[model samples]
Target: MSGANEEPDIPDLPAADPLPRSRWRMQLVWLVPIVAILIGGWLAVKAVMERGENITISFKTGEGLEAGKTRLKFKDVDIGVVETVMLAPDHKHVLAKAEVARDVAGLLVDNTRFWVVRPRISGGTVSGLGTLLSGSYVDVDVGNAAKARRDFVGLEEPPVFASDVPGREFILKSAGLGSLDVGSPVYFRRLQVGQIASYQLDPDGKGVTLKVFVNAPYDRFVKTDTRFWHASGFNMAFDSNGVRIETQSIVSVIVGGIAFESPPDSVEEADAAANTQFELYPTRTDAMKQHDRIIDKYVVNFADSVRGLVVGAPVDFRGIEIGRVTAIHTRFDAQRHSFSIPVEIEIYPERFTSRYQDGRTGGRISDDPRGIANYLVDNGFRFQLRNGNLLTGQLYLALDYFPDAARAKINWDKSPPELPAVPRTLQSLQDSVTRLLVKLNSIPFEGLGNDARTTLRTANALLSQLDTEVVPRAHDTLTSAQTMLDSANTALQPDSALQQSTADAMQELTRTAASLRTLADYLSRHPEALVRGKSGDKP
Candidate 1:
């Protein structure tokens, strides 16, 4: 479609220079795609280089796991991803196949722990809250095994401690679990220093064995003789002193816990070895009770009602507790036709030796127990029921010297060596009061009262007669006496003639006394005055 009007150039146009040949032959527009290809190749090599190992984890459930969504994390750092979630051949477990980064290859060991982390609340701790927002992830705890592993069984729950956490574990054998759980705290002197790791019932099903882990410095406190006890609930006790409530901590009361202590005075062979076995006492009192080396069994036959006495009641020597009641039994006497209560007791003979320490009854009994018993019995050493707590009415067997006690003997033939016991002082007081009450009840009070009432009635009638009859005569006599008194009063008036006459008579009597005294004195002067009465010239 070219027009024919163009004229030919005079020089033939130099053959239309074919797009000038140059060293930079590529087009500017094509350069962009070539550079992009180079970058893409480098990225492909990087992806192959950074790829991680593939691992299969078996979980009890596939919850919170999703293919290509759930990530494998070490300390919350994404290291891999789950490629598939499926069931195992047995269909009992979920298998999560994942790929972890090559950098963490060393962590894929035989003992490595893996678990799915979601929002969990347990043992008073709330964890994995972040997972609620971001989603659950497969968390790994690096292991330190010499061999590597590709397949793993995820933990039913998270591991309580990291493998590198420094601590030791101990085994506690108990008759029962006693409100214990895996994460129950462990205490040393009321300070939380550890937790329960695991537990299993004994093969014989007679007890449970619990494993407890104590963190570093506290683990050193465990000793061969260390005592463990259930410090779960608040220990409440009421005694003669007062009510007492004791607990390791408020948390322990709610969650349950275990406590351990090496007696302050105890000597240990060494810090208990790892996995050392120990016994768990039911209470701190039992755990702290001193172990007795030697024990003696004896029975006391009491005549008084035991009332408040029970098994485990203290058996006291003077004021010191040397034994405890173990059993209480009753016996019927055939000939006497009476029932007697026999209390079986356990006496720690060590308490009687010099090695054992006590303020009262220290080394009072000899090592030769039989001979000592005989001698003590002869010297009025007797067992008697005594009131331990007056308000509680608790009775206890007491060994004391009763100087006036009746003679008695120990029946060694008895299996437990029967020791005679006397009634408590309260029982004696009760008996005396009963006898006095019986005597008072027998008194003829009604007859005596009737006689007294009859006598009172007779006296009342006599008094009535006096008031109606004899009283009038008495009043008449009183009136006559009153009239005479009035007359005498009138006659004895100060200005009356009778008073004047009385005064005159007193003056005459005085004058007569004076004359008599003068006469007497003159006679003394003159012995012949009587014969010469006319010679009194002083008149």
Candidate 2:
């Protein structure tokens, strides 16, 4: 075995044909490594090329943002990752660096808006609820601006409407914000058509200015004469029309909203321009009462209490409303040494003239206020304070004819022709009550009580005397009369002498009649002598 092994070693398999150096040198071992390196480099290049642009978004808070964990989303789809979260140079805000996909690079516009999306409840709506489980994310809303941008200032609150949304904006001036919220719906004839975009104090600080957006097509319905009002909560009103309860919807009642309508009779065909300014009324009735005509202001001096009268009280003429009370104040008339209420009122005469006119424009009843006032005075028109709602204690101004009203004249020389005013019925009743109270206070209660007591004692004594003395005398007189009557009855008994005398008189009368008959027969036999004998018998 040793010898065979030695021989095999010696043979060495003919040196295994001396593996060619060229072949060994040309081996693909290095090529394999090179190809792998090349492939790795290509993959790296592709990864770099596919990477997106990095942008920094400054936010007031870092609430839901996390480095490398939170993603930026568009339309609910992830489009980028938050690379880092750090404070800005000023340290006033958090800067979130995000790497957005290259395909969505064009969406980073100047007007692009970003906000953190977390479960939030606002204006009776629950939004971003799905994020509660999936984790909060950064939401990006692309804008329609032409210029592209990288750095963006994030929005603290989500925008009510997207920049690219088709709509028209309008500005409404209101006395107050009421219950309106950013997400409050706007209704057109009870149909939801838009939403309140935003609101803030007016620049002049006189009222609130609301920015509203109406979705496309529906916006075209807006006209110059359109009216808007707050349609939130229950509208409980008691007027001449009686008690009324109105509500837009249960949701609106809770969250609040705005409503608009283009009065068919007032609105023109053309659409209102974008950002048109309009007045926001407090109620639907008020909005409907708005007229596009000149208003005339006047002042009324009343000698009655204006306790129940308030601003915006109805000013009526002959049971029809023609104006509203604007202000009420008390003034001292030094000359007359009396205090009176000076009430300011605004009247829209166009409301009355429009009824007789053919177009939107109408003529005023009278430009010369003094002349009109004189005419009204002659017609027995006078102002009086009356109860509007007895339960609510609300009052209104009433203009009516009072033919027998106290004579009063209008002072045309005054700036606002002072119209005559009759004392309010309530005031008259109060005066009567005061007079009756004075009369009662003046009565001498002590003297009246003494006199009444004395009268009562005298009447009681007189009654006692009549019962005791007069009654006994009357009884004695009646007894005496009864005795006399008994005596007369005894004298008229049936077998008395008067009865026998009456029977004898009857027998004598019968004998006389028989004699007269015998005489009459003799006269019939002898004519003349019988006549004389009959006559003697008759005598």
Candidate 3:
């Protein structure tokens, strides 16, 4: 009993300090698991807040797309990540599922555009080259749509420019695509200012329609009369001047491009509206030829062969181009019952406005076509076919004053007033030559040749006689005449006897004159003494 009491007392005495009950209630180790639970809950809530929405984009192909690896970028900033890639039900396209950041969710709209970005060579340009090593990525373009969307169709090709980019869009209609590509550059005065956004066949199937974008400052240059043309490939032109080669740039030559230019100040100025339609010319020169002027159409009937005449030939007035040949067709004249070539031409009367003046009123002449036509007809103006290029055999119509042309009235009542046509010079010459050939063919050439041969033989014999007999006789006569001339010259020499006798006669005449004067004086003095015997006179 004593040992148990002592041990108990000692054990109690060793821990005599009192401890709080609350402190002993629960150990700190017991709260570790609860704290860990709370931290996990906070992390879960943060993940929920940061999670993004899932979107499905349909693409023509799955090229360069990798689930969980492909990043969606906007303005070079990562915005989303591709989550999965799968084929659609119809298998017409590949479905790329992506998870975009919550902050960019509003950007995924109906008008948003998406495309894959990889190393691409387009329109003579190298793009996305950095993607080759860093791997391909998806590109997103935000839209102005008010309604948001999740599902979208991806563009097969990247857009030339973003929709939100400050630019103006215009529609260009062309007969052919030419050298223009999707990303072809657009130029203004040889300076790069825009690009070819996209192209498609016209709904009417008449031509190809291209959507082009011009940057802001450059868009102002596009007026209502602005001209657009394909300035691609090397332009090589040969004319009277010489060879001319034109190219916008090396890139334009390699791929293709479009260029635009505002018309001269002569044209009325008007801002071109967005999406305004314009014609795309094949060449810069062709576009430059276009002008804002009233066009007058006329028809001409040619009686001569128009073998070398073709459409698009120039209609010139004194070497100045005034119009073009629109059509060349053969039509049977019902009234005349003869076939004639009907050439339709488009004349720009406005081109002559600068020279227009009313002789009577001294004011600007009326631009009315009828008035101009009447004036032209009264002034002996007529249409004539001429050779444009003698070597190429190209034919053109020339308008000039033909005062001696046959009198023919213009059928003003006809639908397209017919201009009087004069006979082509070449055709008239050919006809005259043909008539001459016919006349030559009709002549008795054989008989004429025989007569000519006989005459030639007679002439040859006569010439031989002249050469032999007549020639020698003529030579002898000439020699005798020369000898006579020499003899006469010798007889007429100053020192000859004839000359001496002439000189003595002159001296005697002088002496006689002096003696006559003295006798006359004596006769006057003694006129009455001896009238008959004056001064040694025989009385």
Candidate 4:
């Protein structure tokens, strides 16, 4: 405003255009970053795609497995990611979509196993904490197991590494339903050897049947003579020493397992000629030593021979678990009440010696009962009753060799006897108890009743004599003394002596009554104490 360019304030010209942007410069700034972003996305897709290599994995249930998040890991390193999850046509396996890393593409082989690594304690696998962070993953154990390149089925865990193939199949039947849980393991010498493949109820629904698999070299040792028993839980006994069998570890317990003692020398071999198709229960044959016709024939009819035994009573030939009483029933005839029953029994051949040498001859597989019995008796053999189930009062035929001189000979017959029918039913056992109660009720009580009456009469007579003779005399003496005192009081009326004397008498009377009450209570509870204090009194 001063001189101005003293030209009178020419109006300010509008601001000139802020320089225009060049197309080349614009392309450098904006277009480049957009192109870079596109390229980056494409690269990520390429990296994640398995390209030519693919593998399938299975999961028990595909509840939480979102294909994008579930990854395949090789030693804690992400090697692939699940791209898709499809249900198998058979619905037995869950087919996974796996895209392997370029470096690990060659590792995918036909026998490659891919199992879900989730929080579980089953069989030989345990991975609880990993499931907490990232959910379950397909854990790949790269191996040279399979020769050809083929599609793989992912397992729930790594395939158990067995040295060789499994041998014979063993069937275990357990009474007391629901004792076994699914996915339990089978062990040999405390080492995980196999798993329980499946379980089902018998046709009659009386028990559970277990299909136990024994793998490889170890399975060969489980011959027909092996002993199988439930080795789980706290088995405590007071005799000899308290035997307690506990789980070796916490994880092993979740998967129920079975352990059997190794057979002597005979090894079970697979019948390669036998078809892969299996029978639920084939005519069970001994896999150890050849069965003797005589012993086998005799034991088959064991139930018919021992059906007359009591419920809690033992059917001991000498003390071995050959069989047990399964059920009892009664039949009433027109003439009299009678019972004919079929008893279920189990005979395990392992307890007896398969082969023995007779003293009269050389060593051989003896079928004669006398020869077998002689061998057993000499080796301290005896049969006794074993109480296996205390709740049901059930007994088992147990065989144990004892060096006792009073060994009894067992008469094993080729056929069961058509002897007189006996009481073998639950109803019969109840009837026995009822008969005992009736006999007890028949005992005489009349003589005892008369003695009790005489005692009561004696007590009442004694009470009467005390009341009439002793009590009345005492009352008269007290009255006389009171009258004499009254006379004395009249003479000393002015001195107030009679008033004080009456008060003292009342106090004395109250104390005497309290003492009498205490004495009465004591005598009632302990009448004998009163007689003891009085030496002349009879108890």
Candidate number achieving the greatest TM-score relative to the actual structure: 3
* Candidate 2 clashing pairs, residues 3+ apart or interchain: none
TM-score of 1: 0.58
Task: Specify the poorest-scoring 10-residue window by lDDT in model 4.
Answer: 274-283
Q: In terms of TM-score, which candidate is stronger, 1 or 4?
A: 1
Point out the higher-scoring one by lDDT: 3 or 4: 3
Could you give me the TM-score of model 2 versus the true structure? Answer: 0.67
- The digit string of per-residue lDDT tens for model 1 on 431-471 reads 99999999999999999999999999999999999999999
User: Could you give candidate 3's per-residue lDDT for residues 100-166 as a string of tens digits?
Assistant: 9999898998899999999888888889999989999999999998998999999988999997889
CA lDDT of every candidate = 0.88, 0.86, 0.88, 0.57
TM values, all candidates: 0.58, 0.67, 0.70, 0.42
Q: Which stretches in model 1 have alpha-carbon errors above 4 Å?
A: 1-61, 65-114, 138-154, 173-180, 199-209, 229-257, 280-286, 331-338, 354-367, 406-415, 431-539
Q: Write the per-residue lDDT of candidate 4 for residues 167-204, one digit (tens) a residue.
A: 54567766642334445666666676766656678899
User: Clashes per prediction?
Assistant: 0, 0, 0, 19
Root-mean-square deviation per candidate = 14.4, 12.5, 10.9, 31.3
The per-residue C-alpha lDDT of model 1 at residue 216 equals 96
- Answer with 3 or 4, whichever has the higher TM-score: 3
Candidate 1 whole-model C-alpha lDDT, 0 to 1:
0.88
Better of 1 and 4 by lDDT: 1
